[model samples]
Target: MGRFEGKVCIVTGGASGIGAKTAEMFVEQGGCVVVTDVNDAAGEKLVGDIGASKAAYLHLDVTDPDACQAGVDLAVEKFGSVDYLLNSAVKMAPGMLKDLSLADWNTMVNIGLTGSFLMTQAVGNWLIENERPGSVVMMSSIGGRQPYGMSGAYSTVKAAVKMLADHFGIEWGGYNIRVNSIVAGHIETPLTAYLKDPEIKRGRSEVTPLGRVGQPVDIANAVLFLFSDEADYVTATALNVDGGITRSVMNHMPGRKWS
Candidate 1:
């Protein structure tokens, strides 16, 4: 049997990028998935592509409490239980803080940070009510632990997401629920279109200790591990799946080589 033959997962932002890949992986491993996203077309397409029997789509804006609960309700309705959640919904507004508009600031914070919080609570509540064990992986960024340039509210929201995971992990541990943050690196997603520039991509790849940037599948693999029974003892943790970029500070120096 596949690793998750009898499991069900809910993936926010499941239309594209890391979320899409994660949803596909879950279904491939024999888990049913509730794929939620504001992108109705893409969401429906994903559900179809993954096979309707194992995947279902919902138009979700994770910032709304009702919407978040609806996602949880959908999972249980379609699949029997809500065994996992990946909070990958995010909309970035990049600009210097001094020039950041209030609308942009709120959008970044609400969708990225509050969205995760609402989904976590909704799913966690359902698990508690049913006396079930579950796992949640919040999508944080490498920027969370350090500065990421020209991302006014994005970095701040990412930082808060990590702490949010930590807080929930502690409060929900007794219920056999695990909450953890996955700090993303320079992933080549639509959100990182700038990486399309060969010069920019090359620069990023060179700096990464692994000598390459990350792909959606790379993150999906780590996420699956966290959601699997293998990680039963893991909680209240932040797993950096960034190709060792965050801790390669010494490699940042010009002409530096740790090889």
Candidate 2:
């Protein structure tokens, strides 16, 4: 049997990037999943590709508390109890703080930090009330480890996401609800594709000790470990899946420009 056989999970931002890849992998591993995103088209297509038997698409705006609950509800209704939550919804508006707008800041804070909290709460509560154990993985960023210019409030929000995971781990461990955060390196995802000018990619690669950047699969593997029983004893921690890039921050994201 596959690792996630007979399990169910909710993947936010599941229409694209790391979220999309992770959802696909979940279904491949025999996990039923509710894949949620505001992009209904992509979300539907993803479920269609994964087949409706093992997956469902949800129109979720993670920043909305009701919408977050709706995703958990959909998972239970479509499959069964949700066994895992991958809070991957986030917005990255690249700009200096001086050039940042209120909208940019709020969007980042709402989607990345607040949204994570909402989803984790919904899942954690359900797991607790149902008397089941589960896991939650929040998608943090290497930016949270070090301040980076021209990344809007990304660093700030991701740092908060880590803290949220830490807090949940402490508060919910007694209930057997494990919580952890993943700090990803420069991943080559659809969301980061625009930042992939050859020079910038090279800079990221050089800074990474692995002499390469990360991919969605890298983060997905880490997330799955956290979700599985193998990590039953691992909780309340931040896992850096950054190719050792965090040993030193990139001097600057070169070739970054204002739109």
Candidate 3:
């Protein structure tokens, strides 16, 4: 039961969704988790619910390098070392290039892309300074590898994060640190709960070979493996957690109806 016994982890955006699920798994595996999010209320509540002994919520804005460093420092102070870093904080704005505002684009890039870089740099520095081998799991999206027209900013930023991981893997491999990414598909999370349209949901399911949506735990399970010794040699790879949907093409039949 204690796969991560005595390990410490830092999960950005750990207030909910995949981050929360991952933190829960880490705690269950005997890893102490530092849960940080801009959402102080939810973050505190989540930490409280997860139990103070296993998790602590820290107020953090990943875009702020100082805050990111502080979060990492807190993790080390509390748990001796930070063995895992999961960059899962993100914001999605759906709009075509023409329709999207520059401000919106900047926010997406800053939070999704720059934030990841900052967190990695800060936490990575800590791990290196302390001479501790660690693993980093970036929560990228399948949309990063494909075109989701209205999601230009998010797509661009995610793709950038993926590349960042690869670069980190190469640069830090000498220190025994591993960096990898997960390209997740349509997982049923509070972030996507707004996709209330039944038709959209059906289409999402139909496109996936598994004929269903993914749960947060599905992604968490993969993150656990990546951070564990099982994946000690795995790095610089974007593992897809999309229910085999990435291989299938959507049917584009006009006026076609299926009962």
Candidate 4:
């Protein structure tokens, strides 16, 4: 049997990019997935592609607590129980701190950080009530640790997501619920589709020790491991699946400034 056989997973932001890829992987591994996203058309398309027997699409606005709760409820109703949750929805508006508007800042934090919290709470409570164990994987970024210029809001919320994982990991460990964050580097997803130019892609790849931009599958594999029983001992940690980009800070600097 596949690794995720008989598992039920809820993937937020499942219409495209990493979320979509991860949902597909889960279904491939025999998991029943609830794909939630605001993009109803894409979400439904994905569910159809995966086959209705293995997947279902739900319209979810992560920023809304009611929607978040409804998504968890749907998963339980459809699949009997939720075994995993992948919080991958995010809203990024690049702007310098001084120029960033208050509305933009709130929007970023509400969707990225607050939305994650709401989803975690909903699933976590269900697991606790049912006396079942579950795993949660939140998508974070290298920007969380190494801030990026013109992305102050995104970076701040990502950093908070790491801490949020830690808090949940500790608070829910006694109940056998694992919580962790994946700190991705420069991944080539729809979220970063703006960097489609060859030069931009090459520049990002060259800076990484691996000499290539990361693919959604790279992050998806990591998520699978974290959710699998193999990682039963791992929790409250940030796994960097960044092609060594985060470690090669000096390589990223122009002309080796310090040296």
Better of 1 and 2 by lDDT: 1
**Once model 4 is optimally superposed onto the true structure by TM-score, how far is the C-alpha of residue 179 displaced, in angstroms?**
0.2
TM-score of each: 0.97, 0.94, 0.94, 0.96
lDDT accuracy of residue 113 in candidate 2: 89
In model 1, the runs with Cα more than 4 Å from the true position are 254-259
Q: Supply the global lDDT for candidate 4.
A: 0.93
Q: Number of clashing residue pairs in every model?
A: 0, 0, 0, 0
lDDT of 1 by residue, 1-259 (tens): 7899989999999999999999999989999999999999999998999999999999999989999999988988989899999999999889999899999999999999999999999999999999999999999999998988899898899999999999999999999999999999999998999999999999999999999999999999999999999999999999999999999987667884667
Ranking by lDDT: 1, 4, 2, 3
Off by over 4 Å in 2: 249-259
Query: What TM-score number comes out for model 3?
Result: 0.94
TM-score, model 2 to reference = 0.94
Whole-model alpha-carbon lDDT for candidate 2: 0.91
Leading candidate by TM-score:
1
Candidate 4 residues 75-165, lDDT tens each?
9899888999999998887899999999999999999999999999999999999999999999999999888889859999999999999
Instruction: Give candidate 4 regions above 4 Å deviation.
Output: 252-259
What's model 4's lDDT at 23? 98
